[model samples]
Target: MDYLLTCDCGRKHTVSRKQADQLIECSCGQSLRVPTLRGLAKLPPATEGADSPPGDTAASTISKNGENPWSGWRGPCMAAACGGLIVSLAFASWYLLQRVSIDTSYTTEMEIAEGNKIFDLYTPEDMSLVWHSFESLGIGAKEPPLFIRWNRYAEDRARRASIAGGIAAACGIAAAGIWLSSRRRV
Candidate 1:
């Protein structure tokens, strides 16, 4: 339930029982102290149509029913969605860095020619088998064939990560708009 607390400037504030004995700032810059629970009970209860003083946006957001608009699932859902957005963007950045690193690795003309020859000789399925075999034998990134394959794999993962990040960003924006609109309803 809410109670009406009158300020010295003649502005009335509809405050909740939880705000008992707390200091509340009035719109006129006056710091009014809410009465204690016993004193508060003696004051008049806020009517259903009681309006907060002008320019009090914080109070305006509270509905007549006394329930906070952002309460319950809305707050938690928004937090989780924002967290997902951050994680998605972080993964996208990491993948993009991996792609750039792989692309800039040193490769001589002779190595390129040898890599092209190996690439042309094997189908994708056969290349995967050969690459795995070479990988297991400790043929590292410096190898022409392995370097080419690793570069391609990194590029693919980067593209997928960026797409996921974009979707997450869109979702996060939409959720924020919805949450704000819900809060503004009074």
Candidate 2:
């Protein structure tokens, strides 16, 4: 059997069972007594709050393959990122749909406003001519027209939101794929 010895210089050395209790020169030039395996086993087990020897801790006890047992979070983090992106995309899509409806309604209102010459681009006498022109064009409507401006702001917002949604969707798909691949490897 092999006995483990820890030197005050923070070095660990393994000695034969027969050499237990014998003084041996450590690589750091210190003469240390080798600990017997039986005595080491007789030592009380470490508790959560108990003080550990130098160079040994609760983290060191659970290491495997030179890695901490709690170090694998890439897959979970990526999945969370993907979920967030999907939620953002859904909101963007809903906003885009709402903008489209607003744009259509605004456009129809602008057409009616043009038929009424609401911008004062013509004289009062020309307003009659404009109404005649609308009638000639088969757009006759007795409803008074409005002076509405195009909703360029909503249009621009919808455009930007669509682009953002598309990019987010792409990133979410890529993240999902990466997360799934990593899961398979684990």
Candidate 3:
């Protein structure tokens, strides 16, 4: 269904039967005149798996074995990148929500601690009273058990989100590279 039209510059263009008697531009800036329909039938057919010109569709860039080199992994790599991004967003949102909840809890505890007279004293002499007040309010420990557990869960989610995001970034880069390479080859 296609014919090889060679230009004066020695570049061959694969033209369809419908393009007979039409003018086509070669990559070397030469305008090639396609043969008539009858003349085209005499010309050699465009070889399958031949190197296609730039801007051609993916199907035109098949190799001698009748397979597109980038077809196998390119699609899967992009899909993986998308999947990773979704996972990262889900984990990140969960972590952010948990962080806000933890912050609110901490603020409430701080407000309660601020209401103590020892806190209002604000003097070195009342340091022991401050400690006693904090102990009485159950705020003396470095972190509450509930807060520790929540913080640990949030940290774990954040870590997972970061790892997923990194994987997505890597996959995206790889896919882009493969796409660029395929384009260059074409």
Candidate 4:
């Protein structure tokens, strides 16, 4: 029979009749003297394993031999899932915020060169070069001035990062789900 022993800390402990005179260790690490037969009679009987200490549950994912059904695979899977998710988010954020700039400079030494002489110098977003022609600056135009082109590189970076992050996060989430589902509770 299980005797319900109330500890000094106000925690109820369940002890077997065989341990009535023994000193039982409570969850609080305090030594409790098992109640005598008369005292046990006064207190109600607790359900077997109902009030057992933490990690000592009769019904759990762990077996009676102190082994989890997952065989230690759950913990690592959880950690990987979490790490992947975090990395994915971080990469995605970084990709979104990343912006690269491309700059091009042109200088014309020609005496009749016009600023418009330099055309099709830069490749367009589609990788196509646009050509330009300058027939007349009326004949003797000055050399073309230096030209610079600026574009945002953020778009590409953001796209890559977002894709990578999303993929990673998805893998992490899937692993986490698998790990959780693989666990069996008794």
Best by lDDT: 1
Poorest stretch of ten by lDDT in candidate 2 = 50-59
lDDT of each: 0.75, 0.60, 0.66, 0.60
When 1 and 4 are scored with TM-score, the better candidate is 1
Most accurate candidate by TM-score? 1
**Tens-digit lDDT track for model 3 on 1-186?**
877777777777777766778776777877777799999998888886444444344345665465676678766766676676666667666665655565424444664676665466678667877678878887644754565576677677667657656765776676677667665554
Pull out the clashing pairs in model 1: none
After superposition, candidate 4 runs with Cα above 4 Å error: 1-65, 69-71, 99-152
- The list of candidate 2 runs beyond 4 A from truth reads 1-71, 105-150
Q: State the lDDT of candidate 2 residue by residue for 3-121, as single tens digits.
A: 35567877655555555566777667788765566775643443333322223333233333344333467546676778868877877887777776664464665676775676477
lDDT of 1: 0.75
List ranges where model 3 is wrong by over 4 Å. Answer: 1-54, 57-67, 97-149, 181-184
Q: Rank the candidates by TM-score, best first.
A: 1, 3, 4, 2
What TM value does model 3 have?
0.43
Q: Name the weakest run of 10 consecutive residues (lDDT summed) in model 3.
A: 50-59
